[model samples]
Target: MFGSLGAVTLLVSAVLGQGFATPKANGTSGYELKQGPLDTPWTEKVGTTPWPEYPRPQMARSEWRNLNGVWQYRNASGGESEMERPPFRQELESSVLVPFCLESALSGVMGNYTIHSWYRTTFNVPDSWTERVLLNFAAVDYQATVFVNEKQVANHTGGYWAFNIDITDQLNKNGTNELVVFVFDPTNLWPYNVPIGKQKLIPEHIFYTPCSGIWQTVWLESAPADSIEKLHINAGADGKVDITVHTTSNTTTTADFILYEPNSELVKLKIKVPVNKAHSFVVDSPQLWSPDSPTLYNITVKLGSDAVQSYTGFRTISKGVVNGVQRPLLNGEFVFMFGTLDQGYWPDGLHSPPSFDAMVSDLKVLKEVGYNMVRKHIKVEPALFYQAADQLGLMLIQDMPALSTSSVFINDETAKQCPGVSLTPSLDPDTVQKEFDRQLAVMVNQLKSYPSIVTWVIYNEGWGQPWEGNDGVRNTSIDGILTDYVRKIDPTRLIDSVTGWHDHGAGDFYDNHHYSSPQCGTPWYSTPSSPYNSETDHRIAIQGEFGGIGQNVSEEHAWKVAASINAINNTYELDATPKIWNLRAHMILQELEFQIQEYACSGAVWTQTTDVEGEVNGMLTYDRRVNRMDKDMWRRDIQGLYEAAARRARTNGTMGVEGRGGGGG
Candidate 1:
């Protein structure tokens, strides 16, 4: 009776205390909290256990349990027996809230000792219906080995993607079950290189303080023996949809696909298709997904006794030479892709956000500021973040976190300690290369279904970009090989082979970066030495990064600058206050008008949306306390650029200010 559902609810509620609510989290954003947790509107709601929202919205289940409250924690060693067998009965000394990493302020263990850590939590399976039970971690940094009831369940590498463990056989028939997770994240330390995107142990400019351990949601859900394993939806060029459903069962089974137009929630079509096969459906008038009208179709997939609620949108991305310039064509028209470099980091929670609503607030700000896309810079966010963009109509440029070895960010001690290891990305170890290949494949496969993500950036400024697969030899074809690999996986979206420089002239876009390009003083102004070689470059030209104007240096929310400030220039300095805010609006609006005129620069991404650590050149402060520029004013100014760009696109685009939706096949 103690393991009953009612008892479990009471235990979960009691375990998550209201004591974690801070004053700054009380809907007050200003100069209130110095060196404390910054509050968004959703912060006050984050009690002890934050991000209680369902981790997987794409494949949502009605009945599930959240195992995020009152997790026991302890520091572990790789050589210790705790790696294989958990410290079962003995209580872990410290208590850390689930999801928040050990290095985060909200974790209660904000200590920098992030090498090895252990997390243990307990949950009960509802006795009503249980064919099989699944344990899912939204993400775990670096490497994690999970144990369910003293039995090792999963061993996963790479830190930025989701993984699951079926603990059906390992779970107890009655009473409660114990779940222990072991996480090892060396970050960008010295000798161990992994897919670390902007996460540095030293925590300087551009690189943020490393987050380790379970940084996303943890939950337990019951599934059928023949449950849906994965669903891949492709909203095609002809405006029809092809859904490939993969189920857990190997035997032949038919799944009922009931599609509902999400806008009206009306059943538009229904079909019963065999599992593990791609099925296409054509509608009379398909509601295409665009930045203006993001139409999603809700679908309920039922396989005998198992059913899941899922959603998908209909759209396509292609490229063509429009008006003598190669540009990205959205749904057969040239639509400008303007967005911010969203470094999905939180000051309080590090990689994990304060709350689900906090993530929504960031997207709303971008939409309000007239941005149509978000280049998720160097980090992978929870599935809900992409889902949020899908619903909000924001296109995303998802970056595969840089795959690095510990030797890449070497110090004096590391150089002396690991004398034999290769330091450069050109000569990464074989294991690291294999891991990158596995992780990259997983990232593309897992995230390919999301409608909002129109581009997958393979490399960023050559962080972990290996020159060659061979022994330290340089080869540019390696760049093309990676691009080819991504295209081979999902040929639906545009591929930016390299974001900034070190671009080996690969991928769909010839992307470039600068501090504040196309401005008067910058080198991008005059056509003589412009970064964009649109006249000769085979690929479409785009400004992957620019307009990094700084603000709010002295405010309480500003992340203090460390030893390095590479982008700061003496050519023309920017004020870290309102002066820059006014100037930021003026500079970007003016430069963009010129950039969009000739169609040479097809699209552009600003430096960032929010300041991360020492990088203060963001539209908003790091903690999101201050909006340096006025959203309405900025929106009022940039609204015309979209129309002009679309007009200059293909002849298919209308000249008037409008939505980018059209009826296809």
Candidate 2:
């Protein structure tokens, strides 16, 4: 049964990257890390369980324990070399923080980048946790193998997707039971082509440091032998929702659902349906969720002895003709998506977030700036990020974690900066392609429940899409096949099969990444590397990425990593012009709105929200302490874009004159 869970699971391969000098091991003591260039206010709040919030916000189970405290760790350069016997009931070396990657400053292990690492901790299962005990790893980097009391229980492959293991049989009911985990993260060094999205072993320009080992929350959950496994919710802006509850048991079971409207705990609707079967319900006069008014319905599900709490929002995302040109309509209106490309990286925590509230604050910052959307770039964030977006009403263009690039792009120069992109472009073997498709489907299933996600980005910069060579092999583009697969799984949302470079003419949106210094003509009627001229294309055209306006407000807050090009070295402004980047950003956006509809561009995503390790083109500094863009002016600029979009809708008789989110019929 354990193996079966991973059998159909899609497998992705990776190649090894060049190694670097390893940090010397300082075993047998708790880690003491230095202050990074800057730290979030919540950095001090990190403790045994850094992220103590409920791991799953959508599906909440009260009976769960966080296993994210300090744990004993040992590094074995060669993975499985000492697999002769499991390290049980003995102290091997050092203590490191849980959840954070081994390479991050927050982990206290700010040490070596070894291929293999071992972790050990012990906990007691409460007598109250009855029926079955389950160990859940929100996500582990490349590979993870779990052992309970020295008995191998579960192993998983994949760094981004969450997986669980049944630990009931192996749990020691009486005394404390030891738990050990062996993690092997090859990063870009895997023998097979694996997805590593912008991560590289050696940090450099464009590509930042790799995230290894356990990078997300790890915890324990208890449920009855037969209980609810997961829930699939398809919510419609018309106040209707269809729900399907998957159960652990193969046979039929009954589930009772009670839904509570936005601010009230009072039950709004209730129903009982057979498990695994979908049921639909409608709320009369539903306050639809939109960028202007983000509303949600909280729901509770009960299946005999098991119960979970979740939430959803009713919003419609579709492509419709407006003024004889296709555009993305939200809640039946063309809510122009003005957003920033968020890396979701931190100087201290790396891939791990400083805190859940911090992520919320990040979204809040963008919202205050009058933006309605965020393009989560090349990384799959934890649940908290999405929860923040849903509550704060920030629509998301969730990007699929890109695999390492294979072929060189014809027009994209950034392709030369990326590692592992020099490989020859060709179609994947039948077996390999099948595996990739299956995994892609699983990712879609896992994230489609979130109301905040408005679009699915299948690929970016043609990184791993070598098969889609120059001109994108339009007839044989894999994006068409993958886009179809995603649409079948969740036809509710839009798909951008290719975000930048080498367009295969697949998916709903046609987009391009345009970057230049603030002085050049931008946000105008120009799109580079587009398969078709925007004037004639049937699909919505968006400037997926722009505004690589680099700046370093405070040299002290910039990354200290010695690289060919980092934020500090690539500063765009000097002592004479401190606010050039900020002022130019406003101007560029103003120009963008002026020509948006005229150029047939429906939306735009700025180069980035905050600075990552090396790339300096961001509105915020790397440490997040300083905002290069003035909030008031930035908000004004963003407002103009929406106003223009709304005015166009009214003129074309496509929507009500109530401004944003008004029905664009």
Best by lDDT: 2
Clashing pairs in 1: 190-406, 192-406, 193-404, 193-405, 193-406
Per-residue C-alpha lDDT of model 1 across residues 5-93, encoded as one tens digit per residue: 12222333344312121122122231111233443444455667566666776777656777765577777744336576577755677
Q: For candidate 1, give the lDDT.
A: 0.71
lDDT of 2 by residue, 225-333 (tens): 8888889997888888878899987768679998886677777888887788778877777788887887777788999988987888898899898876688998888
Model 1 alpha-carbon drift over 4 Å, by segment? 1-44, 77-85, 405-428, 468-473, 519-535, 560-573, 650-665
What would the TM-scores of all predictions be?
Answer: 0.86, 0.87
Poorest 10 consecutive residues by lDDT, candidate 1: 17-26
Deviation from native of the Cα of residue 475 in model 2, angstroms:
7.4
